[model samples]
Target: MPSVAEGVKLGIQECQHQFRGRRWNCTTIDDSLAIFGPVLDKGRKLRNWTKRRQAREQGSTPPAATRESAFVHAIASAGVAFAVTRSCAEGTSTICGCDSHHKGPPGEGWKWGGCSEDADFGVLVSREFADARENRPDARSAMNKHNNEAGRTTILDHMHLKCKCHGLSGSCEVKTCWWAQPDFRAIGDFLKDKYDSASEMVVEKHRESRGWVETLRAKYALFKPPTERDLVYYENSPNFCEPNPETGSFGTRDRTCNVTSHGIDGCDLLCCGRGHNTRTEKRKEKCHCIFHWCCYVSCQECIRIYDVHTCK
Candidate 1:
């Protein structure tokens, strides 16, 4: 449970880091435990049973299955697997530990001596627990499951052979190698790339012998199909130029933007062509630090002024 909590925290931090320049910024709602505020809210209307039924019968699209949601699901799942695998390697959990089942002999100069982080165990734990609640037959469930697996897949794909050298005078006579997960930042970067190239999917519904069946298919035939490691979403992302309660977009109001950038984070785009407000502020910082001979250091204070631009 502690590992799980740590994983959630890790995912949130990574989300914020990756999207800090974007409109959403992965802001968390203070009053709700849904984390990224109402961006991922789906069941809010479920409390009213009539609306839920109408939504199901009419096949109305829910605002929860956007590309941002896909990224969130993938990152969260990856975080859980990463944290659990790390904990298992550290022997923090009694039920799981290092992977001792690595078969075959070692390489010419290295042997598998150290504990290998059990990524399979972590993936299994994440799959069984994280995917258990998404057992519904709807397309949303399928989308969530696919993104979750993609996250876990990122962890597995990034596992590398980590080794330690052994010998006198730091000379490498032999090395002990073990499988280890990559840094979480690397995983986040990979997933962010995936997010950029995420596939747009369409929900295909059909009448089956059992009942109504729904599956996701690529929206465009011109593009390549999304693989298991790729992220997919059934709906388009919100433009995020203005406050939208339905899509949970807080808008770019007061958001800082890069004046030189022409991308989404640029002032022109982020401010939605309404222009921006600029302000000059003074900031004091430590400057001209010099190390003393006695291993101490001292610095002089400096005042700096710069123009800050924010969305109107």
Candidate 2:
């Protein structure tokens, strides 16, 4: 069983990988940890802000949750699950090992006897660790818990069985199979899609027979209740184009951008109409490679100058 710290590190790596091209990329791991702390201390502060804003609004346009927050919640939860499951398969922990118990029955010219990755154990441990921190009986706590569980659920739903055939000269005389978890990158990609469609939730206090109960309702009505697999949030994100220490935004000033790109990473979008400064930069590279007989290759050094653009 890897320590909680290792799990957090893995989660941070995944967050950076998933949001590498986004405006609010996960560059400051420490700041992220502060926001998504064990008890979500920073998140709690945001929730308090939400309450104050609602009080002033008198129940109109409650709050728009930020996609960055949703992504963090999902990726962090998924990171823990991915790391623990991978560690189990690698025999890094003595407490648990590969999931051999779920192997399929023998026959059909194949045997399901390999050490399958134990994703269920990963999910169990993740829930115990991540969900335990959210002990608050409030809407924000509930929302975080739901997003964390959704991350684990995404991993389990994507797991698949892999098989290898063995025989004379690679014939299909016999086969070995095992359950495998999808690559962490794939999980990250899936969650990125979920983040894109994340929903804004309405957390309201309702009177119940027992007492006052906090309810999490989707802002928009859907054909069915919001899926547990969807990411949900309760507050809008700050404009990341300018520095805002309070909201943790460092701004995009001087950030390098693709002049030809029309996406978020492009100058037009990333600079937020601030325009950009262009300058020529010299870059060095190895080029003109040649393969030698025995088993060697050679290349000549090359230099090229290109125009680099940065947000003004």
> Which candidate number maximizes lDDT?
1
| Model 1 lDDT on a 0 to 1 scale | 0.81
| Candidate 1 per-residue lDDT over residues 88-147, each given as its tens digit | 999899999999878578889988878899999999988886788787778988999999
lDDT, candidates in the order shown: 0.81, 0.73
Q: Output the TM-score of candidate 1.
A: 0.88
Please report the TM-score between candidate 2 and the true structure: 0.85
lDDT at residue 158 of model 1 (Cα atoms): 96
Clashes of each: 0, 3
- lDDT (0-100) at residue 63 of candidate 2? 17
Score residue 291 of candidate 2 by CA lDDT.
Answer: 96
